[model samples]
Target: MTSAVDVVVVGGGQAGLAAGHHLRRQGLDFVILDADAAPGGSWQHMWDSLHLFSPAEHSSLPGRLMPAQPGEAYPDAGHVVDYLADYEKRYNLSVQHGTRVDAVRRNAGQLMVEADTGTWRARAVISATGTWSRPFLPATPGREVFTGRQLHTVNYRSPADFAGQRVIVVGGGNSGAQIAADLTLDGHVNVTWVTQRPPRFLPDDIDGRALFDVATARRRALEEGRSDTGGVASLGDIVAVPPVRSARDAGLLSVRPMFTRLTADGVRWDDGSHSGADAVVWCTGFRPALAHLAPLNLRGPRGHIPTDGTRVLGEPHLHLLGYGDWTGPASATLIGVGRPAREAAHQIARQLST
Candidate 1:
């Protein structure tokens, strides 16, 4: 049996929830399809020690402020999970949990969203599925020949698993830095953290809230036809979160250049130097989770769907949210997703009305 609605949101995470909030305000009939079995989205899967770069108040969805956590300036993953669960209930959003959408395609001027449980036909579809599922591992030489265990950020849960082992952590982004810090602070594993380039740490005074402000200012400048101000990228990459700062200041977290190739038991650098390791952790980040949209054939040569604001270039009926800055300024972050989500809903409402 196929049900119909004005809009079908393919994700129940922060982006999808934000879209739902605006769609509700717009009086549009819609339902958010979440792949997860429960609320919290990707937050629940984050490593135990993971914490937001900003306070709870700065990291929130639309129509609600995330409540403060007592004695914690930066909330951990568990706190975020609880907040998301509460946000869903507080707003009474219609979510079909555990319904993973397999495909989305056009059918007689309407979009047909297919899932294991059922199908939905809608005039507009919002692809808010974030990048958590699509972890990107770089094609470093001899990776296949490496005899040691290798895992991506998605599979990592805690430092206890690597206790007493020599591990090499790759990548220079926030995840790489954080995981390295976690392992170093845990005082269990011997970690050799590597990055493609020298790790850049943001100023101690700067945090997620400040980064968001920079993104906002940059976005506003561009929309008003002003020169580019470089935005968040201008400052640095890593946020210098508490753990990272502690480890760095104590000289426990030292980074080396990326390995030239993986060996049977370890890695080799370009200078012919070598190190032995029991495991290698790749925190190389992820691509957009857009496999479900393959039927649309909208991707460009660069492997990304071109967009005019939130709307897909070739398919205006479709809108993508929370992938990255390409979708909107800082759209991938919690506080940043609201603007694009709101705009996407309003655009969809206007389109459906006509």
Candidate 2:
């Protein structure tokens, strides 16, 4: 069946859902096409012990409120999934489930979305699939021989799943630190954290959005050929909560220099050292899935979709949410995507209406 809609939301997570809510309120004819069997995307697959670093008030939807029962301690990963499921029901959002989008193409007037189940055409499209769609694994020599459970943090459930096992976590991102911490303290699993740069952990009292907001202002000034964020400081220049010290003080966890190469019994590092472990978790970051959209004509050399602060660059009918922008931090957390999403929706709606 050839179905035409106002918009085809490619992702079903918070960003897509938020865009849907706005489109519905605008009374626009729209259909959200989700690749997942249900909503909550990554949150549905996150580590079970995951929680929003931001508070409940920070986790609100477009027109709804987060339940206070899971108040304040930051909603766990499971809690977030339940909230998203509930959000879908509460908004009565329209969704076509398990319809994996194979590739999206474009023609003269409209965007064509081809899925495994069917094809959908939309006047406009919002690519809300955050960078987490695929895990980024760097190429290291002898990596294929690691005779342990090597998993990306994307599929990580909990440290308990690796309890009583030796685990080595790669990458220095926030997720890597958090997962390594969990595995060591909560699950009693041995851990060896490998990363090129040491991580800086933010305190529970501070959030990435607040820091990004400050950085954004600075970026804006620089973009306009000005200096400074009009006194607003960058994340590094601004207040820092000392995440590394916080994590170590929080508990005793083992950390190591990055893995220079991989081995069968263990991994080797640049400083002529080797360690054996039972599991390897790659917490390295992600890249955009623009390869399939061969015709989109978007993206920068750094493997990022070019955008005007919040809107996609040169692509009028297309906007990418959760990409690092001057308007917000590139953290890609639920806390950051909301603003970009709302802004993108308003822009798309205004143009479509005209």
- Among these predictions, the greatest lDDT belongs to 1
- Cα lDDT of model 1 overall? 0.93
Question: Candidate 2 residues 211-266, lDDT tens each?
Answer: 54564566567768986654322233212223333446766545667777889988
Give each model's whole-structure lDDT.
0.93, 0.70
What local lDDT score does residue 354 receive in model 1, on the 0 to 100 scale?
89
TM-score of each: 0.99, 0.87
lDDT of 2: 0.70
- Candidate 1 residues lying further than 4 Å off, grouped into runs, are none
Candidate 1 lDDT, 87-185, residue by residue in tens: 889889999999999999999988999998999998999999999999998889999999989999998888999999999999898999999999999
